[model samples]
Target: MVHEYQKDDESSVNSADEALFEMLGILPSLAIGNGVPDEEDDENSMNDKGGAQALSLDRFVQRKDDNWIRKVLANSDNINLRRQYETTSVCVFPEALRIPAIEMRRLADELVWGGHIYPSDKTYETLRISKDGSIEERRALTRIENFVNYHSGWNALCNDYLRRLVSLALGQPMVLYKEKLNLKPPGGSGFAPHLDTPSLRVALGDRGPREFCTVMVAIDNMTTRNGCLRIAKGVWSEDHHVNTVQPKAEGNPDADGRAGAVLPELVDQLQFEDLVCVGGTIVAFNGWAPHRSKTNLSSFARRAVFLTYTLAAEGDFHDAYYQEMEHLRNKWRDKVGLPTQISNDELMELNALSTVPRT
Candidate 1:
């Protein structure tokens, strides 16, 4: 259940305060694990891909028991939010995660120091996965297309809690596909406007190209000043891409079909709303939604986790998708060589992320 951001809610207030303090690197909490932590990090570690521990559907059916769970799901996936998403392609559930601060901090620490924490400098950093799956870190930091490959992070994503939450929100049983965390440190630049469906379509299993959605979990309070995602409203269903740049027309395509950023003019014309919300909020949106973030001017880190899913009937492609990504990353690394990192411009060309942290 999400902690309501209402007045007099001490827990929610404290959580926000703690999140802010943590982002500034001023607060300290118990360090979690010795970096990657082990399988012992979780008892439900079997959440690989969608191979979560098998539970009988009988538990979810009859819909008689667990009224609270049902009610929470009902509220989280209420008609209003669903309608908003359907209409605008974006909606938010503010302060959704009710996990205690101690636990949240522990998880955040594990992810921070776990496998690889890349600096924003892509010039020198590269993550390579050798043919044999051995991981190598060169220069740079992590983002949506390139991010943590650690298993514990995957476990955190496929946990039953999120699965159930996302399932209810999407009104269907979903299989976890790809997960990534965007740790936008203070002063980090935002990404250029782009669509996610083109890449996420591969995880659709049997579903169509548009049969995917992403659930973004806020690890810290997201504010415009700190580089929260700015998304174009009510533009998900349109095939709006053009060979143009900023400063031309309203509602023009931002980019041509291939991997490219939305045109600068389109970005200006589109009505983009900053998704400002407290920590733990879950912002769900369609895969085709055009979204980007801004540079973080505030002295705080904006960390968020994105979990992508398709209907369960299609199949589970989480692990397989990541494995392929690893191979490709390593292959790219080998081709690029070490010491010399890919430039931000090249990264933009490759990932179509319009905004990047100025290094």
Candidate 2:
């Protein structure tokens, strides 16, 4: 049911403008061309700071004016975007955001350190124990969810620009359903082969939208050694609808696979492509894409922000989706004789007990 991004009619244009102005009124600081400098200017400014600029949320806000929208629309090749999505169910844009190197480092530090410094009910961070020959429980962070709600810079990048990019690819307006910051520190564990649609369905139930897309913006260089994402090649065909049914809960001992992951037998039959990317690269894929990553054997950390969206017409479910997921997570914790309340220290203990080291 997706189509090209045709110019809206006069009434539609008026409505969109009204919505934009209303949003601007509520978030005056986010107004287009507000004191924030352009990406090029920001890159130049980093030179004065010895290429080690302090992290500031203002640097992340790109100009979201009508002119910016027009430029984005003009640059996008809708035909090719559609063709790739239809054929492979995935698309990649290398260095699309063009964030400065200092900015990237600053952002990563903010995400990693903020969770430890200020632990709150709003923060959702998960830790993991290293599997590499060390008997000590190496507390490495694995993921942080709903960060956009706190960091204005992330909100601008994820909720505005990235969301618009996916909307262009899908040829329809989309809204944010959820966001997560995934961190794969050295010797971190990888996810088992699975489709996001099934997990999303389990969380949202019948209220979920029929179509969904996830956009990943790489904050660090992703490589084979660093556990880059690997996706099945063209597994989402009309003849086989992988989005409707949930995979079996049987775990894979060798791969350290989790419940609701695709069986190893089926995964072995499909061809997969490793999505190696440099910092600022963006990868978008449909909900049904079977994807996973490997352990981070490399010395560095692999960080990326994953933003999931559904059609705007379906309605915004950002808060509600997180609520349901938290409930399910709490239930699982209770069953394991763990506390429902999560804190910085509790996260470490939880992962220590729950995470199975990958062989």
Candidate 3:
């Protein structure tokens, strides 16, 4: 359950804090094998497309659960902060820790196998997968796209820190549900920008409203030269919905259904800015926030991962990519026991290691 942000008095706040601390103390030492103390230096061990280095989903789920708990409690102190703020987006520079290069490579290998591009990490790094062309038939790229979602980091990459940050800003309980995601590299270009479906009034019909938030972590130095993410600040407030890049002057065929509606005007007026951050920094924003990524021009690969979460009980939590691998999808379905599940506060019963500090 999310920690209630609005309480009557100081005593309650202190009590809540103490309770959360006790919970954190009793939480079991999540078996995060990658973080073991005696592990060897593995900054660059990821090489093969498929090997024994793949991350485990159990660890990812545990970490995500811990993250949800922290997020609910952390935002109680900032319940009123948004009223004074102009935009909903919040960026944290120099995030806590970097998911080492080896981990990234291990995850990247899975990503590539799942049909993502594995381009050289050099200046002008970019990811290219033809949406509708002969290039889509290429064996190597197809494999990458087919297997990326099954990889642990594909979902785990949306680390707990990023999730907590979004929960704090939105002032709501956030739950990550999407199991499948598109893996884009630096210099990648997505079709014109547009708001998410649930963000629109028309789309909100009875299908349970979409109240999702997205958290993006730059796995590399994101710079304008190398194509960083850009956003249209404040546009979400006006209508909370924006169109895609294609020009829609009242007569355009809206024909190409694959490419969402064109919002040439909105796209033009967008306040474009790159999400310039180091490898570990996190960026969070509403699903409806109008944003686009610049073309990658950096020599080093501008690798990054995105995680989108909605209220735990409000929306669908199925992995869309499970369609690609039905067996694996069923396995995950079996593991996820609850239908409308949130993080289990039971973890609070265990104690954290006193000798080891949270790095």
Candidate 4:
């Protein structure tokens, strides 16, 4: 679980990512996956396109065929989601995304391995020495960020479906802050208990809305053996947890360090519950929630997409956040003498390779 927001205008967005923004009323006049018709088309063609766009908007409002989103929204209200969020800082909706787990997994695979969504430079992998002294690699935790920029389907999921749910929980109109595709392969590493606020503060210092919420849509069945998320009980906001920003040596030892990691002593005091969910489950939590996961001990991969949002009134930081992170990552890579870019072939190979030994 992690939390990370803002509204964007047409002028502020690029062509690729503008569709959803426009539909959200953050901009105007563009339907996702269906752009404006060309001038070369006949009058009838333009009229048909216009009708389709209108129908899309109608469907979005009525949620005609997308009952899963509607059901999740209804359930959110049924559970007194706002109160639960205020008290626990987290909530879960099982199979909320509506799509079958297999279909979700397929979409994830295509986004990662299809080689069209994410650019070569945006793909990365982590390497470690095995017990047998062999070099093994796993896809990096933040495999793809701001994926909504590339694929229309993902764009809708984040800006349309998940965004509406977050807005409901937060009791305000929310906008996209950032989104990521997290892939944890069999034997892949897990994150340490940490609050996302510190890292977000570092990336978006005084930018806009500081408050944030995250929605994680499970793409595969998440279980203890497969590195399911474990969130601590309590609202660990800056005011509630004064020492949240203090780095502890026991935190993430990887490139991210311990910036947001909680003190081990404090973590020991909190009651943690493992969130085991079937694929398509939606887990939403505030940025202040402290959460972590363990390495996958099972023989399958654990995959999920995390989308973060902030109050729309705070101004959009989506583009800025991604740009800053990219810059920092590239700088760090350069300092370490590693290639800053990855090739499509290499990305595919990395996906094919496994840290897990075959039985």
Candidate 5:
């Protein structure tokens, strides 16, 4: 039941692979105890028939196979994937880079100082259903928003290449906004599964085609063990009515239970995957995709920043339900960066950023 994205010091598997040889309880020919000499000795002998060489601890440590164990007991009925379906859309950015923890330390400091810290349980913000929900505290500090609106240099780095790549992937023009930070305790989950609020919907109704996206930039190396953001792939740009679910709990329990409407029969159809990232690697997912994070299991703290963007002509989507998003936009209008126009050369460079491996 514990789903992890790719973990550090662990192996990663490819999506196209149909099976893991070990799942059938058959040891692979490559197992450590084969007849081949140990890899530690240079120029080791190889079996002419199978061309198999001995595996040294070095080779063993360097293998790149994905370690996620596929659910064998269930297929279309897997509960984990089904649970993933309710939150957001999913997409795997192949060959993602894991940010080194050393590089992420500074950003981690910023997150803690920024007052973006939350319990990951959504208890801080109250919902209409809970009598005490409205009384919940807004733990955020304005300085954090200021840093995003001003000090964050992400807009400059978004570059024409990143924008065009996003446009091509999501089939819409995209822009990079400021990065968001998350600092929660172990067993804490970051944002619950939900769609990104459009910053420009009322002005240009959610009709045909999406006009923007929010790309997540990992300030810290994200791994499955530490609860990376989980995404439901390929569901972007779909139009779904926003239905408000009233809380049935007396205290409006929390946002997690209220945000998703369970599909009991289709639970078997849901699929979830952890999207792990290295520092400097950005995860460009459809802002509308239903996504959530697993509880952190690692001993270290989890910190990440998000860069939200919008299409050139689209109205803001964040203010649809409330006046806050509108106020935030106007208040920080001067700080928002305009999406850059990309050229042909930039497009080629962006393609180079694709980290997927070749066969």
Candidate 6:
């Protein structure tokens, strides 16, 4: 089963959606053309995976009359209620932006050259789960921060349709709150099942509002073999159970260490949505959704740009976000008794001079 997050109107569904369906990791012609899955399959996916087909959601929350989705799906621009994402936790826009092959290559090269790449940090919560089920982050992989600051092309791409989609999904106005470049090399470690809201609130420092939306724009083809994102269905922050599967175990390091983890034992309790998106596809999910991905062992590298937005009323936190990241990094380093504070000029020189590996 191939699950696609898209505008509900059948007439408005574009031709690009056809291309998206072809790129899926699952069987394209399952002859299963209905909106959501049958009740039995929706309950538990272990049986499907046992039958040689992994747990896939053709539609978890695609019900037409769903209150949160109905208004936004009406195609009206006047409505501003952002609760749909809160209800479903995830949405997808297929081929939302068309990038030529050459342009996509250029984007990758430019980001590798100018982007400040860092190797995996095992202590970091996002990089904690290694592919082998250990808590180790792999080597020979790197990532970049402040990617939006150096690239105008990305900003243009985001502004083109991301804001409108976000607003429609959220039912309110939106603003770019954060941006990050995630590069998963052959041995890159993926995240565990966890909600994004906990870490986000820490970064936002208890801002007046709580919820935010994320638009993950795929720069490379994401497949199950290449560690694509897998999300649990029908779970949100407001409905989250306090005594439930721990995404991160207790006594890790920080306040958020144990906040978002979904134990391997409890993973079967929730229905899983495997995302096998083609390049240029945009995935919009809410903060409280439980999502995780597998490590990349495939020959090709997986690169993605995550564009996160806060409600327009919450004020733009882009600068504050990076500043807070820097502050927390410094504090963590100091607590562990390590050297701190690497300036932008130093980082640029390192990348420009080819000191450590650029990629």
Please list the C-alpha lDDT of all candidates, in the order they appear.
0.50, 0.58, 0.39, 0.58, 0.37, 0.51
Better of 1 and 4 by TM-score: 4
> How many clashing pairs in candidate 5?
37
Worst 10 residues of 6 by lDDT: 350-359
Supply the TM-score for candidate 4: 0.68
Q: Model 5: per-residue lDDT, tens digit, 1-359?
A: 22222236643221111134346553221221112221211122222123464333223223422221122112324333323323444432323222222323444453344335321111121111111122221221111222333333222234343455444445455544423445433333344444444322322334422544556655444677667877656544547523223333322121212423322343334455687665435466555555566655443344555555666565433323124322332333323342222233322222101111110
Model 4, 1-359: lDDT tens digits are: 11101122312212333454445654221121122222232222233344543233223434523455556666644676777778888977533333344445555766766566454224344434242344444344335556677776667767776677667655788999977777765455677677777666555578656888888877666777667888986765668852554533322212334466676567677777999766666788888888888765433456787778888998888888777756655565566565666345453333211211111
C-alpha TM-scores of all predictions: 0.61, 0.70, 0.50, 0.68, 0.45, 0.61
Estimate the overall C-alpha local distance difference test score of candidate 4: 0.58
Error at 114, model 4, angstroms: 1.8
lDDT for residue 240 in candidate 5, whole number 0-100: 57
Give the distance in Å from residue 201's predicted Cα in candidate 3 to where it truly belongs: 11
Please say which candidate is ahead in lDDT: 1 or 4. Answer: 4
Q: In candidate 2, what are the lDDT values of residues 1-359, reduced to their tens digit?
A: 11111123312212343355456664211221121222222332344245564334354444444356546545665536656877888977433234553455566567666766533233222333332332333344566666677776667777777777777766789999877777665555677677766566556678877667888876665767667889885847435644322322322211122323565567677677999755666788987788888766543456777788989999888888877766766766676666777656655444311222222
For model 5, what is the C-alpha lDDT against the true structure?
Answer: 0.37
C-alpha RMSD in Å of predicted model 3 compared with the true structure: 19.3
What local lDDT does model 1 show for residue 328?
A: 45
Models sorted by TM-score, best on top: 2, 4, 6, 1, 3, 5
Candidate 5: where are CA atoms >4 Å away? 1-104, 114-146, 152-172, 176-179, 190-192, 197-212, 240-268, 315-323, 326-359
Go through the candidates in order and give the C-alpha RMSD of each one to the true structure.
11.9, 14.6, 19.3, 14.8, 17.8, 14.0
TM-score of 3: 0.50
